[model samples]
Target: MPDPNSFLYNNMIKGFVDIGSYEDALTFYFQMLNNVYNRCNPNNFTFPFVLKACSKLTAFEEGKVVHGQVLKLGFSSDVYVETSLVDMYGSCREVVYSKLLFDRMCKRDVVAWNAILASYTQCGVMECAKGLFEEMPVRNVSSWTTMIGGYIQIGDSKEALECFYKMQKHGMKPDKLTIMTVLSAVADLGSLEIGKRVHEYMDTNKIEIDGYVGTALIDMYSKCGNIQKARKVFDGIRSKNISCYNAMISCFGIHGLGDEALRVFREVERTRIGVDDVTMIAVLTACSHSGLVDMGCEIFNLMRKDYGIEPKMEHYGCMVDLLGREGRLDEAMGLIESIEPDIVLLGTLAFACRIHGNVELGEELARRMSELDPTNSGLLVLKSNLYAVEGRWKEAAGVRRLMMDKGIRKKPGTSWIEINNVVHEFVAGDASHSHSKKIYSKLLELSERMKLCIPTTQRCQV
Candidate 1:
């Protein structure tokens, strides 16, 4: 063992990398470097496995040192070692270095092409990724998924779906990862029809609804306003994991089905799935929306005491929201003050103040937030709305004036309706849409017709 040569050291490093013990792999790599008994050096085989380990860990500095060793040991032109170096640099987000090595290669294979392509995609350089993707003579499922995920990461869900459709048209069958990624794109767009299409495709293809796919389906259906279908998917899964249960609970929570969420939570407890931070957040959200302050408090206590999960920022946000919605502003404030200062938690209380017509509390929150972050236009809008809601028109106008002076404009409320798989977006108080004139005309007609249908006395009161 004291005089172990390169082969043994390489195998040991490869073992750790293969088992996903990346740090252990690097440790063995360093050990091989300091092999005092035989003065053994890492060969080309050792460098690739070592680089693979570095890639997974995103160990940029360690990878650089390995790269130096590769060059110093005259293994610089070795294809496997070069490819691994390319992948390592890519994973570390050093795209320039990755691209440099990739371009310097004498012959590029599918694996090499895919590695650089993934680097660009992972760094959100979609244009470069697309270019490289199209240039590659052979494209694999990973290539397509990388592009789709990159688009999704950049908030271009429509493009992501288009890429998935193109991927299908090219006779590339989607694996579970690709399906899950596409489902996420559908969820972001709230495209129920497309989500249903994906589900049907899975059924027709007989793809096993594993935990990843099941969780993705549940999330997609719930986001698309079909909680019943989401629950059906959850039920259909043969072996449900904590993720599936969390997604289902979140589905019900978002739809304000608090009781159903709680029932599912109890089922999770009964099944001994054991609650995590995510589970608590989902259940707390359900309670917050359904005005179940007492139940929320009980669950919050249960999370800390029974589950031994400390309250995260999200958990505290949910609790504050629940208590604030129930008009327990002081209680919410007291609880929040016990923790660190969080702008999101403060904003939650500010919203509650507006809802309950507590102008004093709202003003206090507004002042506090302004001091913390003057660039927060959303908080300014909330403060302004609070004033307007309580008939303080002068104060509301003053807030608006402050916004104008600071060159700040709040993002308008946006709503969307999908018809025949085409989504139409409406922005509040904005007439910039293509069909705005027609939409306004129809709205005016509806208003006149409603006025004519109402009795004169009732119309006056309205």
Candidate 2:
């Protein structure tokens, strides 16, 4: 006990960290710091692990105490200690303090740069994140990935992809993390072609396709309108985890493949795999889309009873939408009344009322919608349309006038045509183009042709 070795203390901390038991490491660290025998080697090894544990536990006060000890022990200027401090503060949501420590570092390594960049990203300060990215003297795989990930988190898929391209141009081979970020961009873009190329790269480079990466691929392909390929990818994953199943089921449900999605859900349930809210919402939405009333009812009942999954607002919205689609206006209203009426739920009610020509309910829902989102042009349009359908021409015109006064213009009606791999968009009454006359003539002819193909019931209704 007279000369407690620093190596033994370091090894103990390392073992605790390796086991992902940060609290244990912190406990041992403080014990060593207080021990008289360990006083001589105070600067040796404990601070880094203590900082990590503090970060992991979000022990901000304890972390500050350790920071004092780190400075007193003369390890304050150490690169590793500085980086840990930056990460700890960042994780504790003290980005400003993390940045202060980062700015004080005499020499910043890749880990330090990555830590600060991640802090900015997580804090949702994208401009500052970009500034830090630009200031990095030497960027590594983690730096590039963190930059791209920040963009992704902010829903800037285009900028994220641009960053990915820049990373590739710098001659740095992207690792699995980079691929995961790019896949996210591709998923948002709904591009099966780019997704396939990424899959090819992963396969050719022997990149291990774990659950996270594999699920991402399935999600990308399915969202891009290739559910079959998504299924194939799902099957190819050797270590199929619950997340993989959730991704596939979500994609299938979203794509209107209700039967296929239900099959997958049943299979997952058979395996005793747990279904979280994401899985439940996805499945319920699929059932709603397909008008599977009985199936939806059974699933909703089972979720609350057997699975014990509490129905969230989204689930309630899906149920309302399902009932509304089937012309069960009373049932849909009952469902909405069962829960607090949020914007989505009210919106669904408005849509159903419009479909059933219930002008009263539509007006009520419109009033609530205006309160929830006063300036939403779509809600105003729905309300105006309901008035128009009820032959309340004066009311409809008044609604439009109110919209104008509020400076909320109805969204322009536009259609897209892909001709020779180039997408061309046309707005209503658009006539500035040289081919305007020809475009109008073709659209008129197509409208006539589409009318001929309409079903008897729809033609009668029209």
Candidate 3:
């Protein structure tokens, strides 16, 4: 072949990138750099495409070299090139460098702002992302979605909802991705009312209930204890995919409807849909809860033999739970020893031993568990409770003493109730709420009413 010009090389690189052949794009880039005949210099278009290939390939070192080349070629100030650089560093998990590049930019369009915003969001730096978001003079759907997604990624579902509402207040219409992300946040928060409003909005706006959004809605309703609504949504979906089926099955499991869950599984098996590990886990959990040991075993074998889905630790734990609940302690123990030991599995067995009054086995498992996780206060509490139930007062006292000496204290249980879209949290024995006095007065009134209702001869001691 003859010496190729920059135009020819640029076109070749762009074509490879457009076709998703990232390796070939990078290869052509290097070829252009090392070609003795042409010595083709990369233009602005060439740099972004190459940087994109670097981002996709996660070739950080190569990306830096390209950065240096961009500086040497005096295209460092190009907004497109700079945006690509920010994206590459962000994809490589180098948020600090991405930020530095972003800060140096003299002029930034929405694209550049979104790129940097995503970088901070991906790195779990919500504060910086929020700061940038507030400072951005112009915002788009991607910007809002990125911020909302960042909040969700960090388990701040409430904040995600807040951001979504704020976006609405700004007159920004949520796109499909935004709605899907917000629905996920709603599910995590169990904000059933808010989820219903979102569903209403989707209906009002005529947004298509695609597979992804439908699955999210199913999850939200199921987790919020509205299984009937979840089933309605499931039925409404015309084209049910495997994910849709998985969500419905999981809903039945969570509600302890083992028969319904198994029924759904059988239906899926009859269809062309394939069951994966998640599907099997849900089935096993349902079986465990309902004491369907034989069914659980059959499904567990089918998972491995027919579906080619390997049992993970969660699957084994479910099986152990099933066997242990049935008073088949020996089988449970055998299963535990056959698989790799996990804290959850051991804890389940230890609890089972206590329930069955198998003090000797409980003691052995407790010892092993302490060795595995010495700092777990729950385990110590369980051990003490076990000893106390068996009338081993001295051993129970010793366990308490050890806990005190180690300064290990169990976390106080907390519960939350949401009303009018505001979540109120209460800790056990807490009186910190503003309405605590009113709450206590109401409780005392109820107690008095209960006392009056009971006859003196039948009255029980407090």
Candidate 4:
């Protein structure tokens, strides 16, 4: 035992990583390095396990030290070791480092290619990921799934669906992870038709609707405005996790079915499935959107009293929003003032003040916002609008002049619509669409027709 060799060190590291004890794994790797009496030189196997720990912990500095050892010990070109180094660097967000190691590899295996592909994808560089994906001699499910996930990460749901369908065209069957990633895209797009197709695919292939997938289905259906299907999927799941409950509660929340959300929360309490921070946030958000202020305040107290969970900034933000939405400006102000000032929480109250025509409080909030972030174009605009609403044209013009002097242009607002399964995205005053002329022509036609209806169409004016 005095001379624990490379084999012992590798096992120790692997065992710890398996149990999710990344810190312990690194500790053993260091111990093996410094073993005085019979110090063992790490072989090819030693580096991968050690590098894995570094990757999981995102310990970039520690991983760099391990890379030095790999180079010094002549295991730099070992396929497994090189791949692990690539993975470690990628996980640590050093895309350049991972690609450099990948480029230097003597023999490029699929695993090595996937590791680099993942690096680009994980960094949200989908263009590079796509180029690399096409160049690969072959790809497995992980490669395809990683690409799909990259598209989803950048909020390109249509592109994600295209990639998924292309994967099918390549005769590659999707694994569970791929399905889950695509479900998110469908949810975001609110593409009910495609979501139904995915559900059918799962049924045809007999894919189990396990905890994660069921939760995703619940979300997908809810977002797509099919709350009934979402509830059905929730009820059909044989066993439910806290996430499943949270999804169902959130689904009800989005639909403004506050009572239904409360029923699910009560069920979580009765079943004692254990409430975490996320559960509290979900329920509180439900209450906020549904205007259940009294219930929200009561449960907010339960965070520390019953759950032993200290309310964090997000919790306080939710309470502020809830109170603000109810036009309780004074109570909202007192609550936010009692905590450390958060610009977002303050903005929430400021917005409420503007909504309720509380110009005096809006002025105070404008001063606070400017103090917090002088360069915030949105706040500058908010302040100008608040002044204009109160007929303070001089002050409004002054605020606008300050914005121009600072060269701070307001960010353009954006919106999107889906037509024939294609999502068309547009920003304010955009005319870049391929069908822009046709779209505008049709809009003008509709506007002319709308005027013919006269005062009858007043409520539906373009």
Candidate 5:
């Protein structure tokens, strides 16, 4: 090799880091340090790429050595070098060290601020992130997007939406990343009205619906229960990628439109778009729900033999559900035994046993499940229901007493409904709504109407 301390070697290291060959970058960096002739030392330009490699590899020991080298070289005050060190520590999940480094900086810039802000966000300390965000001297689009993305990452979709609106109020136009992030939050919330407004804004601004944005719109519309709009968006995409097709297929699967999903799959095949594992899963799910057993079997076989896609556990689970729903208990049980045991798969089979009135198998499965999840009250409840259905009230009472003795209780189910761009949450049997009385009165009126209609139907039968 040429002199390891040469500028050529430095550029080569940078090239490797740029192309994501982090290990190669680190190798060159170490070779330069170990060189006996050591005439050329790493300058300000060299430390950032080496630090980036260490960060990418999470090599804390090497990173600490590099930090010492930077201090000895008297390049510690270089803004780029300091910013890179902060980013390196953050990426390695050593946020405290990153913060200490930041506090030691004699001057701060936007890049330095973003690095620490990202560190806090990445570590799931959003409260600290928000505090830093408020203290920032200057806010940019990146700053806003980071905060919004942090909320989304923590499953606080509501807060993400609020942040987006706040960004707009500050006269910041959202770029593609911001739009995609907010759309995802909108989908999770199922706020169709808000989603519609976002769509309208894009249209009014004449923003091009590229692949990423197009996929997000399709996903948002489909998840929000506006399938027609999803299809429209799908048609509008000039270049539909595999994800776009997958979204459309999944949309059909969720709506139980097996034929439509199959048709779309066929179209994908004709275009030679190369369907992936996700596509097969969607196909099998659709067939399962629509009771297309023979078609599902054909597709499953084709996926492995023709497409060379090995079936995952989820694929096996779908097949088990398909067979169980069709009352093919033996086949489902054999399939379950062939694979590793999973709680969800066992639960599905247990429920199927209850539905098909196979109390013996149900009891055995429930017993095995109890051993696996002894603290689960839902399993106990299922066992009790199974006994009660078979006229074994004594056993049912015993299961209930066991639950009481163990202090196990079922969690209340909660649901949400969106209206007028707002979401309302309710738990089972909850009467906390302001209009609870009016809601109950309307429900009673509907119940009385249904009761009167039932007697008229009996008179007609006579």
Candidate 6:
């Protein structure tokens, strides 16, 4: 056996990589490269760590140089080295390069297959991801998770659920990654029945729902429109991470309970949970929806002053909405002037201007919005409102005409009904069926009954 003391440096670097401290591993790698200590060839263990660091840092140029060195050093064909190169390229969104490396491998392993599958999934190649999953000689938990997550991204919740069932039937007991992937799929499907079943599975197996799994479950329930269930899972967890806090806050925001979301956010801050930019975004969005200008400003300032996170465009957009909703049109416009005006900020300002009867400013904002999104129906509709308010009926009609000429129509109003285990969506006058007559008769009867019970002026014309 190798003497332990003789391999101290190698062992130390391995420890760093194992714990995902890839940056530290690279520091050692460079030191060895410069002969700072006794020169050491990066063994199989060392190369993976270096590659991981390069992938994480998105140092594609460095990664290419490293790949060349691996080839020159006769480690190019090493399965581990090849797998890491594939991962590095995939992480960089160089899928073509990753595929080239994948094809060159003489012996393909489960990890190699999983890496390519995940590459396709992350790159938004859903069909390719599904094809790879079906073609893999051996599928691991990672492979299944990749396909499930890909389907979720494509908004094909039914396919994702089907893949989940198929994965289980293959006798693969899902680990934490698998559970997290399926939770998101179930969330997108908005199926509380499946979510409850997943909840039961976790309880029966006594799975430690503490980290990723806990956060995913909270997101699932929240997205399913069951904040109560999400809160229950959140409360049952023994320890919470920053992700858990972010998920719960997001849940509250989506449910229109912005105040409660802010309350949770404060508790998160008080408990010493690290608030990231994502956390700030969720809280800010909540404040915007609830028209909490002061709260939004305070949180935004805290994000910069305390957390040191620079406010990006999304943050500025939320602030504009918050201020605009409160009739602070001048303040919102001043903010846009002070910073880089994004489309969202401009649109919000336009909305405020329309509300406050400031046609000139509204028109200016509408021009900016049109530049950003040339044919946005919502923007044109708001501009038409401004024209209508100013007694420019012809201009308002011209705006609508322009919209029609551009093939952009107003989005129809939508309503949701959760029936059985699935959510059913309906639109007005969407009776393209043989029972249209009966449906219209029933609708008329209900309208008549409502009219009889209420005043004529209160009757719904639609």
**Model 6 deviation from the true structure expressed as Cα RMSD, one decimal place:** 4.2
In terms of lDDT, the poorest run of 10 residues in model 6 is 1-10
> Which digits, one per residue and each the tens of the lDDT, describe model 2 over residues 347-401?
9878989988999988988898889898999898998899988989898999899
Q: Write the per-residue lDDT of candidate 5 for residues 354-405, one digit (tens) a residue.
A: 8887888888878888888888888998899889878898999999999999
Q: Which residue pairs collide in model 3, if any?
A: none
lDDT (0-100) at residue 251 of candidate 5?
Answer: 86
Give me candidate 1's TM-score against the actual structure. Answer: 0.86
Whole-model lDDT, model 5: 0.87
The candidate with the higher lDDT, 1 or 3, is 1
Q: Estimate each model's TM-score.
A: 0.86, 0.78, 0.79, 0.86, 0.80, 0.84
Of 2 and 4, which scores higher on TM-score?
Answer: 4
Q: CA lDDT of each candidate?
A: 0.91, 0.84, 0.90, 0.90, 0.87, 0.83
Model 6 misplaced stretches (Cα beyond 4 Å): 1-32, 36-41, 354-357, 373-378, 385-393, 407-416, 426-462
Q: Candidate 5 clash total?
A: 0
Tens digits of lDDT, candidate 3, 184-277:
9988878789999999999999888877888989998998889999989988988888888889889998788999999999988999689988
lDDT of 4 at 448: 87
Deviation from native of the Cα of residue 189 in model 4, angstroms: 1.4
Clashes of each: 0, 0, 0, 0, 0, 0
Q: For residue 5, what is the lDDT in candidate 5?
A: 53
Candidate with better lDDT, 2 vs 4: 4
| Model 3 CA deviation exceeding 4 Å by range | 1-93, 105-107, 437-462
